[model samples]
Target: MSLQGNLTQQVEAYHNWKKELIRQIGRYRLWLQDNNLFSDDISARIRHGLELLVEDELTIAFVGEYSRGKTELINALFFSEFGQRMLPSQAGRTTMCPTELFFDRNANENYLLLLPIETRIGDLSLQQLRKQPERWVKHDLDERDPEIMREVLGEVARVKAVSTAEARALGFDEGMLEHDRNNPGKVLVPAWRNAQISIRHPLFERGLRILDTPG
Candidate 1:
């Protein structure tokens, strides 16, 4: 559903503000060139600023202890129109890993990308891993199919039973992991280290990113 009330107004205002800023900056850049009043460094800086403004994102992060309803809050705020919870929300640790919800303006297609937990065994950080798309599992998203979407998104809450050594290799502390009741000598860890969900939603399309972090 489209944004409503004051939020709608705010988003519109923000868009207008960005448009005006970009126009003014572009004008300034042209004026500087027309009058030969600025150095090359100044011109480059102004161009960079304009680019940054166009690509700026508004990110909202939900952080709290487990079972504090972060995922539920996200559903209520952004995914309620789906007629069901878009992200896993339950009485326990539903969001197993850090998940980022955003609209991929470049792709303009819905999809989910999950980075394996074992990626942590290497020295690469999450930001670095994001550049290596081959390391992530990709799933196409279809909002038209709620059941399939739910099932696909359910991957975010998945856990795998691993030996203590494997858990340590993934940089998970024993205290932070839950023992798998079904397996005596294994502990359960998040199957995925991180998740990126790209969807076409009004707010998300406007560069609004929502981050759900596990406790």
Candidate 2:
């Protein structure tokens, strides 16, 4: 057989295997749901993992220095189909906090959840925030309206005033503080610690997730 023929066969076999794995994951999810396989909390987690697998979730994480173009990479790679910047990818330091992009078919409407940076004062970790959705300030996303979408997406850049001591407790050091951003009684900081954006996109519909973080 020709070399090209052999390579094609290998590629086809890999895809076939992947499809079978996804199907099995789906079956497992159904089995868990139908049988009440575990406690409510445990089951929820197990089911969530299963669903992502069954849906063939592909998560890409971009992490680098402040001006490293991580957002642009995400836009060009996945959101370019929209022919416009969906996220705040621009020339300057755009992404002030970590952001996650994904789609949930179970979600009835588009939304963005901003978990406050102040929560760190309560010693609540990211895992704790997952269980405490009430702690996140939720925003409705309107993709159909470009103006609204722009306003909504701009929330990532929201800033708040915090005392230097409070900022230090959040792990910011003197060297990290921007002199020009300081106010008389407080230092400016990103209003949010993290963001979860749920929107309907073809790539996300196919179970793709993008994790963009500051490096």
Candidate 3:
């Protein structure tokens, strides 16, 4: 089957599974409510426990240095059905920045959201970046062509030049500054801090968010 068709089947399976889970959780909630009539102390503990199961999105984060087979590990664990590497894995300096993959059930299409490195120099904090969608570059997903998928996802390797002074202000120390000295006045850095890709993978549809951080 094609990638999309495979993803759709996976997602459908996940949806059916989630429906059963929700039903069970709902029944548990009603049971708890009924038990609350028996005791005040027990009710507080049950309420606290229930709060943790509040149907929130679960995030799975990966952390490590460049290479070390981080992406390769993810590909093997979750994307093995591809029978190929789902992510671009290089031996060194691969996955230059963080990349997040998640499913947006409401999203009409798949795309990658890139926040420019320039955003770091501005007054906007990471939280504000989400609010300013205009500052991001969105690349539509093209799974039909392997080369296109490679090109779009490869944006994580994008780089830009920053002045020495500005780079230091962003927490770069002297050692890093000296190593990246380019023309005595600037330094080259990854063009983006993180990349968010929306795809139709089954894990994503089940609130499975994968964070491929600089590893």
Candidate 4:
């Protein structure tokens, strides 16, 4: 099956699973309510399990240090020629925040949404992004409106130009730290602080999953 077909199958399977689970829960809850048997232990455990199951969705996370080719891997794996344009993967710290990718259906058309971790709608170029590390903000899912999730993703996925200052801020410096083995008085400098780019893909359906985490 094609990637889209496979994704559709997975999503359908997940929906079916979720519906069955909900039905079971409702049946159990109704039985308890009708019997007036509200055992605290049983009730609490069921509630907790339901909460966890409700939060369970297909989530694939890709993580790596700076310049570790995480973006390239995604580009090669899922996107075709047209889809490639939707996700602009490059060789730098291109992504500053966690990005989520999911498929959306509207009027019988399927489009991929790339959601970012920001609220304000502002025009940000890649070049400008590379210069200013502070321009990008961490995304808070609770504070954001669900209605605008697609729009936020659309904007965030646009490739912006990186500036020299932004590049430095992203730890793109060459030889900033050097280890001097010959000199007794030489101080050891750390090479680069750990930086991570995460991509949450909807490929995994209905079970929280993580893939490719660096130690």
Candidate 5:
């Protein structure tokens, strides 16, 4: 079996185990209720615990400086089935912003949501912005074509030249940007503040979320 197949099998097995465990817990709770062995507070606590278990997600994060192979490792480990690099991995800083990969069960569709760097000027935090769908630029994904997917995914690494004042206004440190002779008085910075990629991969569908920190 391919790596993707193996991972899918392992995730499915774990999912089944969780379902069986939840069923066993439910039965125990019922027994407790019938025997009058648990108080109202105990029952509530048990219910809360079960809710946590059901809602739990597995998050794996990769953190390092530029050109550290974080993105490359991610492609090799989870996305090799694409027969090419799924995420943009190159010789230099490719991931311009913190990128999240997961499957949104609620949406039930594959798409890429990009938060513009201009949004950084707002008072809202990243977490708050996520709730405001209108604030993001949505790109519907076509997984059937790997070339199309690659083209869309490459947007995460896109950068644009901006004036120093503009970069500062976007919450970027002017000192971090180097002076370029090719583009004097212009600072290059990431076009997007963050990227949220939703796909229908097996591991992701099983509640796995991968965080690729900025490179």
Candidate 6:
């Protein structure tokens, strides 16, 4: 066979595989929707599986010095309803840790899943511990226990009514001020990494699915 013919064959094979995968995803989505599988118990795994399909998914990290309105932008884009409650945006370390928000059809409960850099679930919020990544853990992606993921994320989402002094101690307050001072110039806050996630929700068929990450 000619080399060009072989190349064409290979390309055709890849296209077939891609089409098959998409078809399978569509079927699964329809099945899930019919069965009403959009529950917390299954959302995380469904999300993980969908994320693995993209060949070159983009990871856009919202990076800027402190208080550059990165979180605000996220809020505007992904989290507007939560913003109205004056929710704890003052946690100081908005986007302190690298947060990868992706789409999962199975996530019914609106909660955060926290995974420690290591294997310790002491009483620490993932968002709060952004400045101290080394304190309570090792980063282990091979571990796929949804329960563990839930534990970690739950801790991260547990926001407290922080006092002014407490806020200063954590540097969230300082970061905001620094962001304001640096105005037009870039503000340097904790570096936050993010991923572009696209997933088919069981509820929303066709091109409709869950998209975006947690703020």
Name the top TM-score candidate. 1
Write down the TM-score of every candidate. Answer: 0.91, 0.73, 0.71, 0.41, 0.88, 0.31
Candidate 1 off by > 4 Å: 1-4, 30-36
- Which is better, 3 or 4, measured by lDDT? 3
Count clashing residue pairs in model 5.
0
Residues 9-123, candidate 6, lDDT per residue (tens digit)? 5545655676688779778877887899756656676666666764423233566565556555544444333334111234445444545454434442233333432222245
lDDT of 5 by residue, 1-215 (tens): 87666766777887898899899999999899899898989888998989988998878799988899999988897777789998899997789989999999998999999999999888999999999999999998888998999899999998888999999898889898755467899988899999999999878988989999875
Q: How much does candidate 5 score in TM-score?
A: 0.88
Expressed as tens digits, the lDDT of each residue in 99-146 for candidate 1 is 999999999999999999988888999989999999999999999998
Off by over 4 Å in 4: 30-37, 63-84, 91-97, 102-215
Better candidate number, 2 or 6, judged by TM-score = 2
- C-alpha local distance difference test of each model: 0.90, 0.76, 0.72, 0.46, 0.89, 0.41
Worst 10 residues of 5 by lDDT: 2-11
In lDDT terms, which candidate is top?
1
Residue-level lDDT for 75 in candidate 2 = 67
Enumerate residue pairs that collide in model 1. none
Better of 1 and 5 by TM-score: 1
Error of 4 at 156 (Å): 7.5
RMSD after Cα superposition, model 3: 5.5
Total clashes for model 3: 0
Candidate 3 positional error at 202, Å: 1.3
Residue-wise lDDT of candidate 4 within 80-120, one digit each (tens)? 33233333355544444444443322122233322222311
Q: Among all windows of ten consecutive residues in candidate 6, which has the lowest summed lDDT?
A: 194-203
Ordering by TM-score:
1, 5, 2, 3, 4, 6
Per-residue lDDT tens digits for candidate 2, residues 61-157, read 8988887888887766655555777778776567878999988778756799999887877877798888888999998988777567767888886
**Model 6, 159: alpha-carbon shift in Å?**
10
| RMSD versus native structure for model 6 | 17.0
Clashing pairs in 2: none
